[model samples]
Target: MNTRNEYIYEFGDFCVDAVNHLLLRRGRPVPLKPKAFDTLLILVKNRGRVIEKDELMELLWADTFVEEANLSQNIYELRKALGESAREPYYIENVPKRGYRFVGEVKESVVAKHADKVEEDSDKTIKSLAVLPFKPLITEERDEFLEIGIADTLITGLSGIGQIIVRPISAIRKYADSSQDPLAAGREMKVDAVLEGSIQKSGDRLRVNVRLLSVRDESTIWADKFDENFTDIFTLQDSISEKVAAALSLKLTSEGRLRLTKRHTENAEVHQLFLKCRYYWHKWTPESWQKSIEYGSQAVSLDPTHAPSYSWMGASYCTLGIFGIVSPKKAFTKAKELVEKALSLDPTLSEAHEVLGAIKLFYEWDLASVADSLKRAIELNPSNATARDLYALYLTAIGQTDAAVSEVKQALEVDPLSLIINTDVGYILYFARRYRQAAEQLQKTLELDPYFAHARYALSFVYLQEELFDEAIEEINKAVTFSGRDAASSAELGYAYAVAGRSSEARKVLSELEKQSKHGYVDPYHIALVYIGLDDKNHAFKWLDKAYSERSREVIYLKANPVCDPLRSDPRYADLLRRVGLP
Candidate 1:
């Protein structure tokens, strides 16, 4: 087939220049996968007409056998690139059982005069790259979660090199189950190259077979096999990242170089325990949190000087506070002690610094200390998304809503698909009293992960603030079902019931909660939320005071919680806020 003259299609600020193979927004190139680009080309070529999804997929895949899911992913990327909506179509319209259609107008410009020059310029080499989550080598009897953790750590380490646009772990996790071609995964993720690997563990040793592939041609750039004891897992992770960075011709900073050589533990058993702890931590559920703590404790017992294990142990305790499963006083104390021990073992541990900051801000109510710790943590590892997200929370607590939002934006840049970070952004918006915006963000998060408990809970809270009692009840019910007797979820469910005039059920639930609290203190802040839902300000304030006295971490949110807005008008509310150091 003869090559036709290339052209540029312009609509609004978006320009798709076929000659250069680039999509530009306001004259600057926007990063997009080649498949996505091809999809866009097809759409623009048939602008104003609906293109069947299968037809488009056939054009994109050509001779390959690809699933419908691949087409859906392409559509998602296309929409994201256009900043368009799936529900309210602006550029592409979903034809339901049919397919998709481009609805936007296009004006094409002849590019035959500059086609060769544009093509030459398009070949500029990428100075830095990231190898996303590689598909597991095999599907049977695989430890998928552990593989993901290893990939995430490697990406994080490589990102610390400062010159690479390392794809976030959350984005890469989407391809964890991929059985397709490695080149296809790389194209989907819009990366220049990909590191594909398979891990096999036998006794205390690990065998990792890895290959670096150039996405453009599916050509192997480098390949290696690493055989190492489990005790050297961290070192192995560092080696992989460092080798990739070197292959890409990127300069590693002194700190990055140090990290590439650092060893957190040399005990194989302890390392295994730490990996198991990470496996559970990634689960992000109440049950998994407990399991993580158990595994972390085992790691500590086996290697008392292991800083990463202690840091993760502290993080597990922090999760307990968030779930209202344990009193903040107890949880934070343990977190503080573990983090301190971690820092004592290795003051440079970024995770320990981050968790310590959270402990200080939410439990101790020490804003200055939180700032210091979070800053140090970020200084140590800028690629730590958890640290950035927690720092954003601290910013929100201190009435720096705009700054907090900016911090979360940076975090999203690193962890684009992180459910927790997305939920955090919604929570920050909620605290900023932007109920509708919060609802929209949380709804987007739910769309991404329908069963995400925290996002559902936050959506319920946003609905309540918007006076959408019925919607709030529905979401709260979902949260309760997903969380299953989680104290925080149950407390919120009780509140939703009370607000919706299900007084009998609310009272019954509250009674059961109180009875359960006879052995352990029920979170006073949660009780206060339920009372506020009942419009019993007096009881709400009473519980709020108790929560303050108990140093409840939930109380840290009093200053910004919309449910507490009614209480905020009362003098006692100010007193409680001040007492919690939140004023």
Candidate 2:
């Protein structure tokens, strides 16, 4: 049997996940004899150097006397498993009278787990906890995102334990200052426990110290320190979550322990790259989203089975499509492929399901599939704020306004200060046609961050729906300015201008959009919106049809958009709604 300390090594299209004793080629598992597999692992671990003939025998068979021919047969069988030979090795290179070496470039990956404790529990005592960001002290790398990501990763692991409600990253984003008291911070977040930690480096060694504080008493319930080499950094992160379970005196099941300890990739650099890129990705700005894709794609290339990295890549593509940064059909197709691959590698990945659901809802026009993926995502990770936020949007689009409101409310609770999430709440209320309440909610959201472009953009839609033309124009102008006059916001500005009866200004902006479309992407839905404001029914229909064919994102809003009421009477509009798979 393989030991728990083993890892998966990938070269070319093949992967060997030693912990699971899995050998996969292009994502499909390959079967191998136990002895043959062990031989492959020893060769893989010492890939650069050729093992001596006698040394290989002793390593494989500790005390037993293995015949020379038995070792030779195992090598032949292992080579067959890899579809290689001693003559021309694509993976293993065999030297005459000497042993073997792995020839191909290898990426080693391992999932860390908790094994020291196996006690069982029937019930959980602690309900909630917030894992605050870890401080990086005496650091050489000087990367803030990497420092914070250690705690964030632990939060994800702890959240996987069914009995606990671990606060999402957004909840602690504002409390990342090293000076903040953990007990006070936990109380502010309304959690029962606070997990605080710091990472300190001494040469190639790392010393991590963690304390779990009870918010109820402002007392440390548990504290521990871990000292290990830098390469074991992921193990330290996993152990923190395990210790949390241990501290609670609640035993974890095998599945729960696995979830708490699993690291997506064994490459520490790739892990850091993923965290830094994800930090920028969550910013939700056009420039930051593009930057995330560049870095996220790099991590995926290094470890194709890295599910979380694939999830990020898919989400970036999906967001770009929605924001008109890329062609929706092209972006959605790529997004679907990536998310599907991510799920294939790890079906429990909640973020990947959310991306897939978004694609189905916005582009594929498959509402049934969309519902399944989104619901499954939430079921797997209830603390996933983005999944809840997205499901809220889907519910709103389909006219389940009350359900939409409830979902967003839950999301907002987890991410109370998130500008985008707060903006979404106002948008959901607006979809329910509670215009006065929607306006107030949006105003509050804007008050939190006056320059939050999405909140301003959402406010414009509410204003236009309420027929407050001047307010619509003002809010859209703010959005346009804040977004650096991006095509989507500029197009909305043109639409609002047309609705306000400023024909000259509206036409000038229309001309700008027309000119820009020649050089960059301009969603057909935006052009349709401008036509709607112009009361150009035929032109509006024309662009809506184009948007539907291109799977334009805003097309999903056809049923909920109050400004499109004029077009709702038309047969083409109903057909467009039908094509979007909305009730």
Candidate 3:
């Protein structure tokens, strides 16, 4: 009964969607009679200008002989739907002896419509796609877990398709806000199409409505609705993937078909827990990672055969170890055991292999096995951004700096919004000793998230290399504060102090780090960094030995980290490199 238009109007919390013939308040649809919506559209279109009652009735009814009362009734209904009393007249104001005027301040936005195409042009390929988070049926009450979970599942199902580039969850998470326009998101992501949807849950059942839209022409490529028990979510996912693939005319390979229909766990509850775990994991904070572990452990306990749960937990532990939130030995041991268990259960698990590869590269220092695992992980799922990111790190460790940069850049294409990925690109450039380029890259990363301590800490390294001591100290100092004075950030601050001739402050920071190591699992490598800065070669070598004996995570960066430049000419440095298996 409604025709689409390439325009939308926004005022306060309401969106007048001429394109959909719907009035949404705070992202939830409000029921309005067809005639009432038509009247509202006209008033909003001609806001701040009054039309006489005769003109308003004639425009709405055309040749039909409609009474003035009918037009007045529509206005009354519009006012009620807008939550305004006629007397208060916030949105609709009646001019004496004239038609009503829309008083609300409106912001108009035009949806760009691509050039018209004939039926032959319908064969245009849908190469890249984005699945945005679903909106809830109720605006005031949200089920964020379910909303993100469904989109994430669909993303995973389609990611293995080589013919299509499906944007990862990290890149699409920002669209979780229901207010986001799907086409706008698609344009920003530079994707061919977008899958936008809404979900409603009642008791043990769900009602979902989804439509795949073309970003080029705003055409509906495919649309569907599902009503089923919540436990049947797997079937919903399979149906959606099949329909989308068919709509796009993708001739799926056997592997892609299998991937689309694969079920990691039959138990719906365990699936929900796994989704919650991943949701928190992407938050990329110490507290969030801990929460991720808790949820992942719960999922694993509930369904031990859920390989993804184990792998995700392992990944969380790996991150904790790298950030010094957990001791290296304890964290790596737990992470390795978990991922190994995951591999034993599901040998083809891409992320499980990724986690194993990271453990081999960073903890065991088994360079021989690292490449195989990472390559296998990527071969299984080319869209696994984390695998590519870790592979970049491995390449950097092996002195393949150019390959490492390429790999990280590829990872960015998959998850352009990932804070860690952005930071890693700059870090990889830093390790390559391209100080100016690294500084530029890190500054861009800071623009993405100014308070991201990791980016600031990395930018500090770039500043230090450029001999910008004051800037380096300021950056690391902010990094320390932003990271809640984490040991890694504090150690970097100490290094900046020493390099800038603030030996007393550097020693103060070193003293605190030593105190921390006495009680907790502080990486001695951090202490060594300060020693190297202080030009205390003997003490630096002493701590580096301890680091090697302990297999500190930071040891992998020895071949490239500029902070160790002072000791590079020493025979001990060569011996350490030989012992660590770095050529």
Candidate 4:
């Protein structure tokens, strides 16, 4: 028997048995997605040596055409499993425009416990799985979010089971539009099994059609159709999860099984509104956020006891604050109130905890409480990318730049296509003084989503830092073109022009901003940023003082804002920082 085939790598209170495909922390099994486990194996194999991004991608998808973003996502999950941070660098070092290097020291050990037999038996066991977004039986009535939601819910539910590793939703979302072979989708997601389904909605009735297949030979493992009224949607979701778990031969604790059976709301109207809110939530625009709030409110109105609706409502308010669509005080106050209501209804609601954490960090500036809240939220729902992303932001705010980077990386792991998370990572790199890396990240984001105005804005800022004034103006102009009369975009364009000695152009843009401000006051902090870009310290200080008086949301950027550097020597800057509860 080939007992020597069992290869194990040990590092820092953790061990990875490559032969058995097991990860252990403190000698106990640790749950991880299949791609993440593969990533770990690759990193540990090349420990202390930089692994180029292209090489890593090829190794992970030896026979697949997976997107580069998928590789990024896997690395994120691998870091989380190792309890490592991207910014802190205890385990992995990002080579900045190159690749990644595993910095953690490793010791190899050979375990001899029936290694040959275990290896043989593992061939028959399913090691990896992918849950493709369900198709809509009625094409015109396709509810993509609902279909994606079901797949996501199943992936998350199966992830908790220790038998097999499930691919993260981000890794599987690419297959949602895949009209190719199921085996192809499996390969893309790096999974051995593929779960695909279809949904049909007709007035008050619903039907869910599902199929599970083995990618190795393209064999069907399970197939079924769930027919029920709208009132049974939650039950339908649970039944699907249970069937998948059972098919996978995973044992579910009684409590865990019961949790899968519970329903949050019985009202059909509430459920419909919840679905609509989710649809708009993912759109992630100011207009969509407002619509989400309306839909979430309607959901709560239908059933006041629905905790998720309140949580979504709170999230909408947070979005408003994040996008600078409303006064921070108003947005934060509303978010806090709605989150508290959700908590009062169901303290275990993970979304509410996350929103509360964000409010604490961005509004109250309570670092300790913010950390605690995000930690609890992550514990409650490990699959939630938003929770992890916000936690990363909290880390950045508290000077834990490396950890923040890791958190955002993890977020990208769960939500690979998330424009917001990608932009945020660029912002973090910018703050860390990695201007070139920041530009690369932001540029990648722009490539993925050219309509992403904030990413273009970040790119312009990075170009400015690099002293590429023409390139900065070019990027800022693109931002203005896409943003369409956004005050911030206009201000940024004006700043770029002013910094490049195009004073006439700068004033022209500023005059447009002044005109817009006549209808609704533009953020004085934004004005200050532009003036600072123009090297007009007097004008910048004047606007900054106004921002202080108005309590602008951009005040949160004071700590790391390079545009505010000119103001740092002034005593008023210190006073402003103190007023904002920032050091």
Candidate 5:
């Protein structure tokens, strides 16, 4: 029998990580008994070669007086866990009168790693940090996302490292276009250090200057300047991450060390395309997500091995479903496949895990076991606002309103200016039935960007709950104007008109939705909202059943959504809630 080493083995759709002692199929854990797991591990080590039954039994039960039945049971359990039939095995094959052989193709997954990881003792060690945008030094038409995009990338790399809290881009993006000192900004964020840099692009040649500054005394602990072509961006990121880790006195496991240095794609152009997709992706708009899918597909086609691109692709589809841009059935199924592929490739990707969490909550609605993904994502990256927000939503769906609000508040502190995060605070408050607080929170978001449709639309919902028809109309109009008469916003206006006793105006809005459905995807959930407002329970239930068939994302909100107040007393309401698995 051969000895098993420290590496992950990938075969078919499953990954067995020897370092972490985990067996995951598409990022989800599959339980196995200790001996059963060890048995499978040994089989994978010697694939394509059959071991004698006596040697297999001796290796497995060297000390114990285990019978043949026990060995057979272990193999049976392993085959059942892997969904392999004994007769026509996908993984293990029985050689007649001999031991089982692993028939699946196996490859050891290698992540990037560095040889330099040292320890130090210092009072002002970086316990927390914020990676501010890399300033563009030479270009006049600097892409706004490019500035923050560099920071976001660094945040992803540094998140998996132990003992240092890295603030996400959402928390510090307000300073991206400003000229604030790194230490001062870090002081405001209450972090121990700040990483700031500048990028100068001259045709294909690129110059990057970066510094890690201690917030305590405003002194530079590490600083460097790199001159290379655009294609070497991955190497530059690796160097910066290593320097930051070394200066902070952080200890990284072999696997964690590999995470910071993994390359997404070798083609520089495809890498840049991925950055562009992420930039538009954070916008959280229907049109922007479509653009993300476009560029992300290009990147995937160019380099199929790029896990980051697949992670972002999953996120785009997840966002589209969550925001009601498309049907959750189609969108989330695609998202699930992409995210599972990403996790199967790189198990430590916090971003991919976060997308998986979203898919579980908003699409699967499988709340009982959904906490694992959300918690793991946040545990991997505490500064990740998106993961935190999704967890908050999950808590709310299960009637943990206070915990949900607390979680969102923490996320908001890390990303005060993010329109989506800010808007979500109001939405969460609304779910808690704190109408006044919800209104106040949403109003603040509108102050940051009145044109942001998400905030405007959420404010309208708050007004509707409070029965402020005039205010609701005003905010809904702003949303329609900003979103180009979007289906959700229009349907919301119809609800306002119906509840206000303006039947003609309500019918006019419904007519528009019907016409728009001919050209684009209109959520049946939106139509059901209008029927609910019209006080037509039969029609509302009809459309709602249609929504359930479509797996509409809005169905998750039925537990807390105030617009469904009229239907709350009906028997079907409880059954609907039950079917959605709400608390």
Candidate 6:
């Protein structure tokens, strides 16, 4: 019966992740409404035989009164979604005046559970936990960043303890409501316990109230209140983290103990500025990223020895470069310099190593050496989900699908609610050539946040691979709109147009990109994508060469990106891969 794990049904190129309620074909999602999918599932389950219409209707519409039209509509939608024609059906066969049956050969396989299963937290001796963002007690005098920043710091401290799985701030920040129940949030996060609190400020005095609640029993495991001088936030964070760890009965190593009390900057004001930088950084918008860099730069100026500030600033620069908000050459160069400075100042900083890994991967194309930096970052901070995600990306670029999927899955466990990590999962699956699974995963991400541009952009790739050009163009159009016509999304939209056989529209996009390039930096790799889509091999190679010369971040994925499939057989592609040193 396989009670512990669910199953995925594979037939031809289609996969049905039954537990996730996802249907994908050739790694691209086939969007069927609930009833349509249910209808398809029943047919697939009863394959090699036909079920009577009356019995099938009863199975599908149990305890509900539904007409024959409703059942017929579901079948119609299922066939449409699956691209199954009525006259010559490859999958679903309609039994004349009787019922329906799936004609394709089906293979059922159990979904492989991860070693560190998040869902079984209650049964584990070592607990999984989440620290919800501390609400502001005094609404009129609230410092939003400080309130959330306190919880972020606590999560960072507790993450060093190998005995506990502390959910990253990104996973729990959404539970910031003053009236939200900690137990409810804990249950939603699937953690054994939750640490939640409130922050209040009055002149030079700062006060915080916190409680650790057991999700299983809805009991307060520990509770406390602290009143300290505003400048003593470092001691406050240390006290809270240590007390929570003690309450959990975690056996922390000496290094974990030190990590609990570690301070990047002694200057409280500088720390505040750095927290502000982090606050904006997590917003994941170009303007917010710019604001993050501004705050980080201010922190650096205020306390030149604050290595975290430099690391975060470097991260912001790297993100901007990757997003094509600025020239990759300019952004990555500055990012590399800042990250190197951060490393020189504080060699143990995990974030610096993560940023350095990204710089090495995207800028230097130093695939051989990138693993060391990424691994070091994870070693220093196991809860560094971003580091794990980037490492997964590096693994994908080097053609290690299984390792990449595993690494990204671990990242998802740590920060399950992170939009970017969720998108990265789909993106990696896309590179793995599991288009259906990619589409399913990405569609679920969109369910989390419909307006997330990157998820849409990633889904477009899955659609392109499936030759669902209209859906691809539609998804990329939303991505372009959501991302404020960001060059990357805009470029992808052009590629979609070209691939869809809309040459005039694709050329129009190319012309627009050229004009935009005159005013601001545009990745040559983007132009190359459109050229490839248009089947202009010469033009594509020209732009790709430019991208190579500029060390554009997008070029690093040459080995894995399906858009570059057309170029792979070319000698120039092999030379590019050799020059970039990618295996």
Backbone clashes, each candidate:
1, 0, 0, 3, 2, 4
The pairs that clash in candidate 3 are none
Each candidate's lDDT (Cα)?
A: 0.76, 0.79, 0.86, 0.77, 0.80, 0.84
Tens-digit lDDT track of model 4 for 1-583: 5555557999999999886678988776676656678888999989989999999988887876545656675677677777777887678788989999888889997766575677666765776777888888777888777777777667656654435556656556656673656788776555778899988888878888889898877888888999887677777888888998788766566544754454568886677787677667766678888898999988888799988888888998987876667877788899999989999988877678999998887767776578678866765555567777888776666556665776688777655666778999998888767898999999898888798888998988888878899988888777778877553448887888887888887777777766766787577777777788777888887888787676675676787767677678988788878877775
For candidate 1, give the lDDT of residue 217: 65
In candidate 3, what are the lDDT values of residues 302-409, reduced to their tens digit? 988998899889999998988777888888999999899899998978889998999999989999889779867865776788888998898889777766786688
Order of quality (lDDT): 3, 6, 5, 2, 4, 1
- Scanning candidate 4 in windows of ten residues, the lowest lDDT window is 254-263
Q: Candidate 3: which stretches are off by over 4 Å?
A: 1-123, 486-489
C-alpha RMSD by candidate, in order = 13.5, 18.4, 21.9, 8.3, 12.8, 15.0
Model 4 alpha-carbon drift over 4 Å, by segment: 2-112, 116-131, 140-194, 201-205, 213-221, 249-251, 486-489, 548-551
Expressed as tens digits, the lDDT of each residue in 1-583 for candidate 5 is: 2333357899988998765456778865565645678889899988899988788989987875545655775788688789987886999999888888999999887543222211222354566788998887855756666677778778877876534568876577767765677777887777878999988877877788989888888888889998887778777778888888887776666656876676766788887888888887876678888899888889888988778888888999998887777778889999999999889887877889899988888888888767779767765666677887887788777766666787687777656666888998999999889999999999999888889888988998888888889999888888888878664448888989999888788878777876776788778888888889899899899888888888888888888777888898999998999988896
Candidate number of the best lDDT: 3
Backbone clashes, candidate 1: 1
TM-score of each: 0.72, 0.75, 0.77, 0.75, 0.74, 0.78
Which model is ahead, 1 or 3, in terms of lDDT? 3
Q: Model 3 — TM-score against the truth?
A: 0.77
Q: Determine which window of 10 residues in candidate 2 has minimal summed lDDT.
A: 115-124
- Ten residues in a row with the worst lDDT in model 1? 121-130
Q: Give the poorly placed runs of model 5, Cα more than 4 Å off.
A: 1-126, 141-149, 171-192, 202-205, 214-221, 486-489
- Per-residue error for 179 in candidate 5, Å, reads 5.1
Model 2 stretches astray by more than 4 angstroms? 1-125, 139-141, 181-184, 249-251, 486-489
- Candidate 4 TM-score over all chains jointly: 0.75
Quantify how close model 4 is to the true structure by its C-alpha RMSD in Å.
8.3
